[model samples]
Target: MDSIYHTLRKSNPASARILVRKVLEKNNGNVSKTARILGISRATVRRARDGELNDLSRRPKNIRKKMDCFLEKLIAEEAKSTGYRYRLLSYYLKNKYSIECHPPC
Candidate 1:
């Protein structure tokens, strides 16, 4: 329907695609079946279901790397100021940095 298209157009395309996939799954993957239920064309349903969906949820890898570096620097600075136990520092690094300090495995 025009209203459905308008409503979905207001949303992020990736989210709209995900919603279309859910509808298709609920209808057992039958495009015509889903289209009939959704009141949209089979082609539109298929496009929404099989379109090159963008993952807006993921941060860029470089951003993640920068965050890790920043956290590491913060941990080192805090350790210098607090002079906390090595175990505490190691725990902070492990939990926050996701870096393994002890190689048991």
Candidate 2:
């Protein structure tokens, strides 16, 4: 049976890399043997050995926001002119513009 690393994914890169290093040491730095044990490719084991172990962000660079920029600007403008807090701004947006807004915490 393969090790848990074969099925497990999106693991913390730093921790994974550390584990890879320890396993490599135990196997006397054999990349092929280490890869088989970890259930990963030899290249992957090599990458971990080469020290590229930082966790990559799961969040995408271009995220779709619930409130678009235009609406956010409008809310900001209203808040600035009216000197109203987020609660009041939220209320005004709901009642006057018929738009639902949850003020950012």
Candidate 3:
């Protein structure tokens, strides 16, 4: 028989996952043997067996807001009153309103 690793190398990742599933079945569901035969990790064999071949999302669930709503509103009001741009407005807020102004984290 041809080397099992050769079968995996000849196919793309999707097809390789499918092949891993088939090989796993042929190996009587032995994850270690399946991984050794296919030249892949045991985790990868388990994922393929469980139909989890797709990539997972990397995005974080909770995004941090750049600034607080109250602070933003206060800045907008100050800007309208003084007609000052952001850099100067930051200084104005610091000096006049006693609010520390810096770039949002």
Candidate 4:
């Protein structure tokens, strides 16, 4: 029991959660009992039981470039020649080349 406490304390959060969940399973999923044994909250025990301890990515799935290669090169040339910043370049591209350039979504 003291060894278990020391092991959990020394391990990373994910590993600790895994250990707790294994113990919870061994105790037949008694939330309060597991929480009490681990000296953690019942909500923490429940969350660990439900496998919600792992980190989730916040990145978007459908990420893509707003502009293509040719348009990118054109913008570079225009920027080199006119020294225009993003907002000005966007306006210039829209009005002059009929390109719908805007900031990334």
Instruction: Quantify all predictions' global Cα lDDT against the true fold.
Output: 0.70, 0.81, 0.79, 0.78
lDDT of 3 by residue, 1-105 (tens): 545544654665567777888888999999999999777789878877886555557888877756788988999998999998868888999998898877444
- TM-score of every candidate: 0.44, 0.45, 0.49, 0.55
Which candidate leads in lDDT? 2
Return the TM-score for candidate 4, rounded to 2 decimals: 0.55
Tens digits of per-residue lDDT, candidate 2, 1-105, equal 645554343555577788888999999999999998888899888888985668567888886666688988988898899899988889988998898988778
- Give the TM-score comparing model 3 with the true structure, all chains together: 0.49
- For model 4, the superposed segments whose C-alpha errors exceed 4 Å read 1-15, 52-73, 103-105
Q: Output the worst ten-in-a-row residue range by lDDT, candidate 3.
A: 1-10
Query: Between prediction 2 and prediction 3, which has the larger TM-score?
Result: 3
- Name the best candidate (by TM-score): 4
Local accuracy of candidate 4 as per-residue lDDT tens digits, 22-93: 889989988888888887778877777786565567788775765678888999999899899888888988
Clash-forming residue pairs, model 1: none
For residues 1-105, write the lDDT of model 1, one tens digit per residue.
364544775777677677778889988898998777667788988888777776445755565324467665876786898685577777766887676554223
Runs of candidate 3 with Cα error greater than 4 angstroms are 1-11, 66-105
